[model samples]
Target: MDLAFTPEQQEFRAEVRSWMEAHVPKAPLKTLEGREGFDEHVAWERELASGNWGMVTWPEAYGGRGLDLIRWLIFEEEYWRAGAPLRANQNGIFLLGPTIMEYGTDEQKAKFLTPMAKGELIWAQAWSEPNAGSDMAAIRSRAVRDGDDYVISGQKTWSSRAAFADWCFGLFRTDPDSKRHKGLSFILLPLDAPGVTIRPIRQLHGETGFAEIFFDEVRVPVANRIAGEGEGWSVAMATAGFERGLMLRSPARFQAVAQRLVALYRQHADTASPDTRAAVLQAWMDAEAYALNTYHVASQVIAGAHIGAEASLNKIFWSELDRSAHRAAMSLLGATAELRTLPGGKGGGEENAWLEGYIFSLSGPIYAGSNEIQRNIIAERLLGLPR
Candidate 1:
């Protein structure tokens, strides 16, 4: 496949870069985990929606440009290069939105996609329950069919963005007697539903972005179900493919981090260890390599190649690249790495940002089904090895 960008694509990149330069916040908004920060980010999402920049690859009927994946990559590169705010509606735009488009009925698409693209409703991923963190099939949450609705009763932990998100999508046991991945259904419910409760889970950085979502006989319409009654596992695996494979964690993000790491190393090269310098260069090279592979994948996807268990490979590579790049940043920072913000009233800089990145990078191996589970999937499914 040809790797060179067409003139049209280059012009699109220029267009995106210009828009971002004019619209991205002059100063970083507050941390998105806090109530104030969440509000700020939502407003930013609205701003993006105003320009139809919320999710470029989505069709125009859903408030997108109906662009290709290659354009999405170009958009992402421009977004990161401009240091744009993190996507507040990422759970919806990146994971569930794509899944719904593929599995949802026409009515379901009309009801959910427009609002999601407009940022009028934000979504959280309720994938992990107390008993079903990495082992998703161990879910005990049950959603019983009742007339026209499903009465959901269960608890979910480590639910990202639930504290302030408008809705959540997760797997539930629709059949009481079925075990493991069988008899499960993917359901979406509003957070403010009468019997629903949300308790924020503070992270190591003392942020409340993640939450514990409890559903006590929460009644949701059967129409909220994506796919058929017992087809949730398949639908959910499709969602996970998006989360682990391409959309959720774009290679442009690491490419941006690598640029920052190189800048930091240059600032501290006079006193940095040899190992630190070596790591900085390695991070830059890896980021470029990941970006190239992402483009190649996009080309194949355009040619109708579906992302499958190979998503596990993508997840492992990007997660480790993130961790290693951040580790190198911490090494370069030394004691200053502990400071959430810079000293001597220096204001927010790489010193402050590196600490946050370093802390978040630690979780890369754990989220999105965890690197361990991913490896098992690669070995058993991709490599065709015995379980």
Candidate 2:
């Protein structure tokens, strides 16, 4: 693989770096999990749209710059380097946006993608159910056909961004008799629709970024369904691939954390143990390795190779790397890692960010299919192990 960028790629990176430096918030915004923080981030999304940088890989017709995955990686690198706020519409731009592009009708794309890019609508994932856990094939939520609409009745738990987002997309059992991964349909619905109830779940960190959605005979138009009935398993597998592979968690995200971790170690280096220093170096190297591997994956994707069970490998490595890097940061902070409040009890930015990240990192091994589950996939599919 060619590790060197061409002059044009370098120029594009410079353009992105300049724009991000000029427009990124000088002071960090609040966490996008809170209502105020979520609003602040939505506004940032609109600002990005103004510059036509919302989703650079998307076609220009859909509020994007008509770029490719390589350009998207560059954009993410500069974005984190600029210390930009976390995206409030990640569900829209990353996971659902690509799925919509593949399975949605042109009318659906026209109605959804542009507003999604413009930040007119934010999205949540409604895939996980209380009983189903990580096994999405075990989904039991029902969407029964009724004339021109489908009546949804069930519960979805651990819905990211559903606490304040505008819309959601997930799988539902369209045929009541259908079992496992079969007879499901991918459906979209507004959070404020009638008979819809959202109960926010506060995490251990005291943030209500997730919610449980209860749908009681909620009627949504038939047009909200993506792909054909009973084909949701296939569509959702594609979405899962995105979530597990390159799209959802970019390498630059971890690279930025590694940069911060290095600085953090230096700050407390005098008293730091040699082990901590070694761990820090390992984390940094892991971040760089992830970046190079991602570039390789992007090249293959551009050449028409689809991510498969191999995505499970990517999921395990990055998630564990995230936790390891943040663990090193927490070690550097020691007891003060918990000192998020300033003199007046106001939250501090840099100090607070590390603690917050460490807390968030703890969940990495669990979400987007748990590392344990990913291991099973690797064993059965990749390693040809007997299940």
Predicted structure with the largest TM-score when compared to the true one: 1
Q: Candidate 2 residues 9-85, lDDT tens each?
A: 99999999999989998878888888888898999999998898899999999998899899999999999988888
* Candidate 2 Cα lDDT to native: 0.91
In the order shown, what is each candidate's alpha-carbon RMSD? 1.2, 1.3
Q: Each model's C-alpha lDDT?
A: 0.91, 0.91
Structure candidate 2, residue pairs in collision: none
Clash number for each model: 0, 0
Q: What is the TM-score of each candidate against the true structure?
A: 0.98, 0.97
Per-residue CA lDDT of model 1 for 73-96, tens digit only, reads 999999999999888999999999
